[model samples]
Target chain A: MPERSLARYPQAVTDWRDFSDDGLTPTLRAARGLFARNGYHATSIRAVAEAAGLSVPGLYHHHRSKQAILGALVDATMDRMLAHTRAAEADSDGTALGRFDNVLECLLRFHMLRRDDAFVASTEMRSMDDTLLLRHIAQRDEQQRMIADIIAQGVADGTFRCGHVDDGARAAASLCVAVAGWYDPTGVLTADEVVARQLDIARRIAGFPPPP
Target chain B: MPERSLARYPQAVTDWRDFSDDGLTPTLRAARGLFARNGYHATSIRAVAEAAGLSVPGLYHHHRSKQAILGALVDATMDRMLAHTRAAEADSDGTALGRFDNVLECLLRFHMLRRDDAFVASTEMRSMDDTLLLRHIAQRDEQQRMIADIIAQGVADGTFRCGHVDDGARAAASLCVAVAGWYDPTGVLTADEVVARQLDIARRIAGFPPPP
Candidate 1:
């Protein structure tokens, strides 16, 4: 797949620091908050419009339906996630382990720092239509494959000793994704600490050798 | 905390085989399906009554409100999960590693086989009121403590070498919980295979020694 920039995706924001009201349009900001809190099935277009401080017609002028808003939010989240993963890979030292560590760290940071988006993207996919679901699933699959491929390379190059590369990849990815569900911003551990701990866990999950 | 039996929790059921409509009351069965599919806020008491072939008042006779049904579902899920974890520990070989493997396996199976209940319990917690939320949070914390305590035991006994016991416990639990989000019943890997793979991954995460 061709690498797409954040500019190509209107809803895509930079990072947790970039997750301000300034980054989102009024419609998207309101919809994201409502959808994240109340869920898509329970949230109505009028409520989103009201929250965004616009009339229903005004909201419709930019986004036709609640589904559109959801799709936009999900799409934007995937776009930002994929961008981070790719950038991590691109900035790596060209070693499989290097790429693996960088990508995994990027994923952990994204899920923890941008947890609301991550939670909505992970949980509300069931509310998406078939086409929208397929689009996001493809993006998700691509991300999964990225991790799996890196693991495969590591195994081939003797950097990783995992017996089941695909399973190891899945377990590693699942561990990072799971952070979004439980990570507390106000908790004792800072985001960096959580990421560091997860990186250690991921390395072990991938069968990386201990330090000599 | 005192251990509770399935009999004490009316909504609790056995493993995947016991997930038939026969195990659930008509009201709960209907509500579970609707809540899993459409989410708690989107589902209505009338719809649940209609699906269960009961009148509005009759549904009320069984379930007082939509929130009540959601509470019952989440409570049942937690009850069943705790039961499985305790049972696995009881059935272990009286070793920390043995208990860890068994508990992780039980959790993986529960999440994959009873995915709808798992999904509902996970995603609908946001819709729960504070009291219900605290109750379930306590149950969830108990489960987390189970894994962490086992890991701590393993570390103390030199069976595990993880540097961060608490984070290791969290990662191990999170990896198993994530199976509910993506495990496809019709997929190639059976539930047992997934469980075995996760156990291997968990052992690695706990830093158990390789064969000498």
Candidate 2:
């Protein structure tokens, strides 16, 4: 991990001086806001710097380029999401269908919280070089695959009625990508509520049991 | 609507001339290729015109601006998709679930045929103004609402089971958005095969019976 990441560079902007994770929340938050609204292709280092109330050069000191900041944002986000999936799984106790619901719920909540970054990650993978793309896709695919594995286990145990593992994989991936386009944190449904609702939908798609 | 839009426009340097739809199957086809490969924002009118084997002014006589071409292309494609949805509704047998399967099949085939336009439409709508945005979303939401209504109808009839209508609506929208990301027409699956598989998957999500 780059030490100068947004996690480490928040104060670099707000105070017009260098600061790290303990001080960089404002900078990280601002960068996320800009990247979500304008798209990375349309955003520049100067814009993020100004938005956070820092000089362009000030931003440069914390991160080498606009892409570095982007990478840091994405990497940090991916870690948080994957960890959420694990926690959700650990916390839930039920049949395969119940576990499945919990997983989708976890994804929906994470997706809502990181909605803009979710959109950025889904759309901008093309901008990354092969190594970066490979790394990101692996992380992304692993999340889907974990869900797919659960579905596959369900299918094997006769808990769900999927025709193929690939179908489950496809559904899991589609569900995640779908979240980026229309999800709004301010919408009537709380992220917690949404997770439950999406889990219900995911279960139905996976041919699992409806909640009792 | 722009009489002769950018689709038929040749590059500012090319020998192709005029932007009219009259000899246009080849030109529009080329424009789709470029838009798919380079994305709508990065692509220039000159590049589009050149790709079509026409000159810049030749391209311009047809399209007043880059957006005119994009709008016309979207309009043309949306009409086709709407037609496909209607046809799917008409062609399917049995209950609303049957109709939904047809819609899903149509969706898979529609995206396969117009994957480039689908990619463009899903990602480029934010760039359009209110007038175009309204038109696009109206058409898109119309189809989504239709599917949601069918799912809701299925739930009412006990053919499908889900807790909420809004969740069904979200699911339908999410399913469509997912198509833009991972579809590859020339890959292992033929277009029809993909439609068949996706229809099965859609049926499961809607909580309807899979095809016999």
Candidate 3:
């Protein structure tokens, strides 16, 4: 197995501190919680306003409607995910295996660390209007392509012997995205343990050689 | 790879015909659609009754409340999944690899073929009350254990080389369950193709030897 120097990256690239809810506006933060607990269609603007300590009119000043809030949240989540993906790629050792390991670890960590954002962005996609949906889907496709490209490169170089690059990439990404659905902060495994285990499973799926 | 005679099982065991909405009552069928599209928290009893073409009183005769409908839907989906799992196990060649392959294929096919039920059972889980949630969790845990046991047996018998059986099982199951979230009947891949690809991916995740 190839190894990269973790010291080359900034501390935020390897730490969970940057994944907190600090970047979100108060209204978006409150709406994220409400949308996560209650479905978007069931959560009213009044409820979001109350949760965020704003009047309904004041909330409307920031977000035009509930749909707008949902769009903003999903967009923001995807943006952060894309940024982390790029950072992980940049920190890799310029090998397909190294990029695969780093990117998969980054995704699993993001999904588990930002559990609520991931959950809402996944489940509430149906609530977005067609325009927003298309844009979000494009962003998601870019992330999927990142994994597919790595696997393709690996397969070409004989680093990964997987027969099906597209399906293998989909499976790798899908498994990591699922961490948000079942990860428990209070559970037996820490986020690091889960990420490490899943990274191994992903490598195996890609047909990477086991460590000697 | 070990082979099993799928022919030994009844026709329903290997067919998608059994996974249709034929088993649901009219009201439950309507509610399944409503919950899948708008979500459980947003759907009401009146909406379900109207969609089912039943009077409020008539709908009440069958189900006590909206939660009852959701409970019944989730319960029935789990029952079917468990039944299929047992059937797949029975039909296996009595080897760890065989059981893992059959069960993983069965799970992927069910999630894709019965997409709506799987979607509702997964996303609306938070809407179920304490008792219902516990019951549902037990059923889900049973499914998880089925995969874990197979991987553990394989590891012990030298059929699989994967370390961390528990996490491997979770990743295998999680990747299959995620099929329902993204599968499209009208998309490029057919259900058969998707299941075949996902089975290959699951086998790799479990450290099964690649085909020669």
Candidate 4:
């Protein structure tokens, strides 16, 4: 087993927090809540305006179309996620196992804390056009590949022992992403507990014991 | 690690295959495809009827309403999944770890092979009314508890290691459920490979190695 680190990944816009309360923030937040609750296709612009307490024209003033809102949400989610992961990678300086734990912690914590954002981004990804979908997919792939790289490095240096590094990486990433699908902020497990448990599962997949 | 066995669980009409060409099979199949592709709310009863090549009334002859279709899909998925798991438990004869692996395999295979059903059941579960939603949640909890029981038994006998058995079980079940979200029939990894990889991950989370 290797020692795990508590160093935080450089945080990006915390689930779109940097958006000023201006033309689009309220509208986008309403859209995210609506899309997270109702299926995206079933949610109309009128519904979004109603949720945001904006008149139709006012909402239209910000977002040209409903698809624009969906596109923006999906694009921002991928961008923020990838930025956090890249920052984690850049800031990490330790053994491969330590780096792997650091990156996994960052990814799990982001998904756990931003459940609604994650839910809407994941469930509504199909609503995006092919071009936007491809772009988002590329960003997602980069995040997964970064984890894979860390696993490969760990295997190379004899810090991890897994049968297939690529498969292990994919499973670990999938397990982390799945947390967004079912994590309940109101549930028994606190956000911190969910993050800790998921990191434990990641270590198990990496064929290592939890760092003492 | 407790030894895993090769005993087979009893099967239950694998994913609606035994349905005769009758009032509900075609309609349910069409509904699954539509619900999986276009989503539940966006897919209308007329669309399902058209997909099944039946008139609206004819479709209603079997399913009274769209909500009925959604409920039936969700309930049947839970029933089938629970049935498979219970049967696995009944048929298995080995250490707690062996039964755990057996149950996990049934679950992972069900989610992988019945991706469309799993998709609709998971994503459209919210479409069900309060009664149906509660019913389905109970069934889902039963499945989770079964896994937890196996983990508890393993822990009592010194066959598995985890910080929390309940959390381990939830994460393991979640990881299995997520297979439906991304498993591609034409992808590079065969279904067997995916199953093998997931089983390995499950074992790791159970604090054990792949059975050899």
- Whole-model lDDT values for every prediction: 0.79, 0.66, 0.81, 0.74
lDDT of 2 by residue, A21-123 (tens): 2223455556777765655666777888888887887777777787777776767667656766766676668557666766677677666556666776766
B27-103: candidate 1 lDDT, tens digit per residue: 77678788888888888889999998989998777666788777776777787778778877887897989999888
- What is the interface root-mean-square deviation of candidate 2? 5.3
Q: What are the per-residue Cα lDDT tens digits for candidate 4 across B1-212?
A: 01001011134544332212212256777888888776787889999999989899887777778988777667666767777777777667868877988889889888887877777877776677888888878878899999999988888887788768887898889878878777888999887788888888888887774222
Span of 10 residues, lowest total lDDT, candidate 3 chain B: B1-10
Scanning candidate 3 chain A in windows of ten residues, the lowest lDDT window is A1-10
lDDT of 1: 0.79
DockQ (CA atoms), all models: 0.55, 0.31, 0.44, 0.34
Clashing residue pairs, backbone N/CA/C < 3 A, model 1: none
Model 3 is docked with a DockQ of 0.44
List of chain B TM-scores, one per candidate: 0.88, 0.78, 0.88, 0.84
Best candidate according to lDDT: 3
- Model 2 C-alpha lDDT per residue in residues B1-212, reported as the tens digit of each score: 34444333333312111112223344455566666565566667888888888788987776677777777677766766666577677777858777777677666666655557777677677667788889898988788888888888888888876567766766755675576677775689776666677666676677665222
True contacts kept of 2: 0.33
Please give, for residues B108-206, the per-residue lDDT of candidate 3 as tens digits. 878888888888988888899999999999999999999999999998998887888888888888887888888888998877888888888888888
lDDT of 3 by residue, A1-212 (tens): 01111111223445432465435667778888998888999999999999999899888777778988888788778877877888888888989999999889988888888888888988888888998999889988899999999999998988888788888888888887888888888998877777788888899989888323
